[model samples]
Target: MSENIQKKIEDLREELHQHNYNYYTLDEPTISDFEFDLKLKELQELEKNHPEFYDSNSPTLRVGGEITKNFPTVQHQFRMYSLDNSYDFNDLEDWEKRVQKALNKPVEFVAELKYDGASISILYENGKLKEAVTRGDGFQGDEITPNVKTVSEIPMQLHGDFPDRFFIRGEIYLTRKNFDKINKRREEEGLDPFMNPRNTASGSLKIQDSAEVRKRGLSAVLYQYISSEFPAKTHWELLQKAKSWGFHISEQAKLCKTLDEVKAFITHWDTARHQLGFDIDGIVIKVNDLSQQRSLGYTAKSPRWAMAYKFKAEKVETELEKVTYQVGRTGAITPVANLKPVLLAGTVVKRASLHNEDIIKKLGLHEHDFVFVEKGGEIIPKIVGVNLDKRNPENPEIQYIKTCPECGTELVKIEDQAIHFCPNELHCPPQVVGRMIHYVSRKALNIENLGQETIEQLYREKLVENPADFYALKKEQLLPLERMAEKSAQNIISGIEKSKEIPFEKVLYGIGIKHVGETVAKKLAKNFESIDE
Candidate 1:
């Protein structure tokens, strides 16, 4: 690669990096996906044709498209604690009594919206954004500062006075509007949409390229100041200060003086929560007085000063339109119920996972059958049971398919198994991609640079068909492909090489052998000496 090509690669990297920072952290994208991809492709093409000229900061490497053998732990500055939960009014009432007793007077509780998403801690120093980390098991978390910096609402610099080290806790959420749009785009592009907003938010945060994070449109809401120099006597006061600092704080907070008031606040939101734009699972109640909070202390998992008042799932009767089949990556054929679009748990429920063929037969479901659909775990809408009386004789009974939908392979039902599997593991295109994905999974070979989309691209391009073929990939072969750069290819090669020296157990697990899990693979590795053995 010539110096001119190297310079061009560096320039492209800087440009893409700037765009990603602007879009993700600033929430102000100036270019569309097509435009960004076009630029990335151009850079990739340049670096591919000249392997020596690849830049590490290029947008294509954001996925880290390389495998990570291990995730080194880092202890947190403060203990990342969990919140105590109260499922019933009785439990909540008891919690209020404890708070009142601790205070020795009438206590005012601050009730805020509880988000159903990934918890993150944002640290700032000298009014500039410093680090962002996940609440990993409440003790230590992965340093995702680079990825977290892309979140737009999380200010890179504080608005007011600078603090030495301030930690703020927030929920990273994907809005209903953005989620729908993302799914719609996925559908149009013939890709499976994300299972839920929580999954999407988690995946988006892990993207190595800061530019990719900007495109996902993730939002954050600061609820608690974990550690701050700014002193506040109550949770409500801390929220006010957070709002002043330009962090998005919950507006639905209510100050209640008694258990009755707290109950009223919870009850009001139970029905009215649907009006909110984002997904909120419950109300988080915190003791207003800081002294009482300190005295209450914490349990092993959750803090006693705080309790989540979860809303009950709303169930309604709806007609089962039909039952469909979805093939899993493992070739398991699971049934899905097609329901009449009905509002459930603040979202429209058109379909629900049916688990397996056994469930379909057990439900005795048929078309135009009146079925009671309940919001499973307050998220997924599931068919609880069918009202046989409402079943019309004119409608035909549901039947499971004998063949795989994609490859027309004969589906097999093994003994003692509920799911039907398509036995064409090696022949089926989906299965091939699935196997490749498993081999490159985090817990297996830990190939960090490989991604589902990239695998699909390789499959579509006929560059690879099996796990072994991945090892044969060369720098020249990757550079010519869209979005593949010299640096990206090298990174992937390095990641693949790192996988070779990993324990035999990981290699065994990566093969996706039937009846062999991580524990079994470890056992096999311990018995064997090498990967070949």
Candidate 2:
């Protein structure tokens, strides 16, 4: 390894993530899509051969950023892990060679559909469902038992003969049919439809309201049999046993005896994936025998015996109508690409993110230009490049702005910062309201019924200015608002009063201090004990 392998990894990680944001989050890509994939390939190869450089938050993870601290965290008895990804057959072949070398024997692999969904860990005690947790950081996750129980497919009580205590890992997903229905309903109700089944499933799994999660129609299919006393020697046997115990294992899972068979399975799914009701991004190939998997062992972040072969993301073309800007809580002004509504990856996207001025300039974009869009991670729609051959000459070239959208103040671009900042944080309406909203967010004050709309209304009415004023709110004052009812006002005030007893970390997080989050707040609370200290 190079002396700067660690630095190489860090630099690659940063470069790849910058591209990912431009591609995925902003719908803008500074590099060609093929070049971007090559970068990911480089990073994955480095991480695979040298596991020590593995970073959990690597762009390769494309890890969900939907975590909220409202739910209690649960530590897993066995560490949950991610699988290494293989973009092509050669990568898969190389992985098998490594596994065979580790065990010094030919290996039979079991192939299963890699569902494009969220992962969950469920525990059973005495053959009864005990707890379910989101796979957070591969060790500790959020306990979402109540919400998980809403998924009708997951049996609350196991029926067949089974272990007294056991664990199961599964991919929680929303079927495409159900996802469309939900989206249609959302669109009819004038709410922005969900982006994809994977995100919808992830967001659903963490909901506090079981009834709402149930309506989301989420389902789970067991992917692994986990426990201190793992019984079956072969993975195939475990799947059959899990299915017999009322756990739904995907019918598409196949037992493969060789790498050729695994490739066949991958090829079969690549074309046939659209036929399946639920979205599947790739195929997972694992050593058939559990003993082989143990011997093959694991890296810091992924299983050595298993690897995921991802299908190429589908691409589409759409028209960019205009560019708009929005301000984040941190005061960074981000450019947004307002596109003529088009359906990609089963969701209608009215707009895609443009990231910043640099990304805008790189694409050489113009208003009303034709651009090609692709779901970069099969999660977010991004513009890889403009369709230059079809560029509209009549439309004007895209121009950058200098003023903050929330407040008409001149924006400041700090040295070494990619984003422009609004210096007028004190009076910017969006920043003020954004801060107030964050203070009462579920991860902070956790004030129930005080949503963004309510906070904005309170600010506009001058009924509340800062977070401290919330506790002092009078029910009489709330009644004068547009549609506030006597009971609603009482509930709001009651919820506000209840927040007074929240932990000191939560209070610190709610304080809206720059660079402070729940984790930082918790650290401060633990060391200081009191604010003065």
Candidate 3:
């Protein structure tokens, strides 16, 4: 009876894996959802009853109940370098010229959609999924193996010929349909809707619950295969091999023999991208020949053989309702345009940055004017231009504020700076709170649990005023604050304690000094032994 059960489990696992590949990778469902679910339920029941027949690569594992308290940081074997960006055909031509000049030969290209999502590096050993990591700083990233395993699009086991040990890098993205579904559920639950699919998908990977990660409906498209042994001679061929191995590859990916063909591919996708259920910000053009890629080599930050042609930012006409001023941590005053809510690039835009007085002047702002708002690089929303035809001549022109809105302090324009600054840096409320927030940020001391809201809450309660006061925080005092649980308070205290071991360079960066960035802080730390110097 036990032998019969083990055979049944193995057969079910293979059949489910094939069905998953067919539905997801091939875009063909061999069975209805109800039938699939029933089969899955039977297998799940059998597996639960017979623990001796457990298989790590079983389809049942995709449901994901594993909990990860902390994801361990692991160094990548091959450094995941970023691609150099090109805005126009001229830039692509220039890149092509440089590549040809270096190689002194004709070259072919592979054009693939640059998916706007979290970058992931997944390692497979002996045809089995071993580890998955994020593209943290190129050199190292957090190991999110359990979270990645939850993604049904990524095959847990290879089917065809593959390298003994290899790493496949790809983008993990949330489909537009799934994103909308999630937002709808969140809205019903009285929670703030996620800003975008890319951000939501990226954040899902870091979630402690593997079950939650599974529910996010994350998908991946493997683009690059890295290994010591060469499986194919060209990039396009590599993608084909990866697809045969049960990895999802983009069907839109095309091989271009010439730069003109590459341009045509980019031009086609620029408009047709809207039809895609997933978000793609641009096109990635790479030299097709593996030997040529290796010969072309890499620059300091990106691959010299490949280039990313970014599509122009999506622009939408919206009514500019009003203008607001914000004070930054450096006391720089920024003008913000409050707009009538308009959807652009899947996200609603209600406000956009005017950048400074110079940008405001360049745009020729007027009250109640219809303006062009675009997401700069598909992330930051900014007002690009004014729709003059729709602008009312009777409306008054918008002017930059002459004083700090937060403190009523007179603002002064610094020499060579475009934006006006509030000279009251020491006493400005925003600057003080911003500085404290910056001190515990990821690049700074990295005190966990000390988020912006918590800092603001502490400031409003009069429990803390500056970064120095964080060290004096007591568990008794924290427990009384809103939403402050005992474990959270203890975690914050522990994080604060751990931050003391951070390097002097990071400490210098955390101090919120004017013009002191991470690199500058590192340089200062190298020059001086202590802060006294």
Which stretches of candidate 3 lie above 4 Å from their native place? 316-365, 376-393, 397-533
lDDT of 1: 0.77
For model 3, name the residue pairs that clash. none
For model 2, residues 1-533, the per-residue Cα lDDT tens digits are 56588888889977875664454333457999799888888988888878977654465543223333489989988999898998988898788778877888878989999998899999988765788898999889999877776665666556567899988999899987899898776533223468788898898877665666777878778879987677778999999888777677888899988889989999988878867888888999989988888887889999998899988987778899888888876687878888888877556877776778888899999888999877654334777789988986888899888898778999999888788889888788877777777777766777887877788899999988777788788998899998888888888998898998999998898877888876899899999887678
Ranking by lDDT: 3, 2, 1
Clashes of each: 11, 4, 0
lDDT of 1 by residue, 1-533 (tens): 47777888878876876666566544568999899989989987887788776543346554333433343466789888877778899998888777767667767788888987789987877655667788888789877766666565666645554446789989888887787787765543334567778778888777656666667778888888877345778888887777666576776787787778888888888888888877778899888877778888888888888899877767878888877787666788878888899888667889877888778788887878999888744235778888888888998888889999879999999899888999888878877887787788766787867877878888998989988998898878888889988888889888888888878888898888879988899899888886667
| Candidate 1 worst ten-residue window by lDDT | 63-72
Better of 1 and 3 by TM-score: 3
Residue-level lDDT tens digits of model 3 in 415-450: 898989998887798888888878887668988888
C-alpha lDDT of residue 360 in model 2 = 89
Which regions of candidate 1 deviate over 4 angstroms? Answer: 1-72, 188-190, 228-230, 326-334, 364-368, 377-380, 388-399, 403-410, 414-417, 421-533
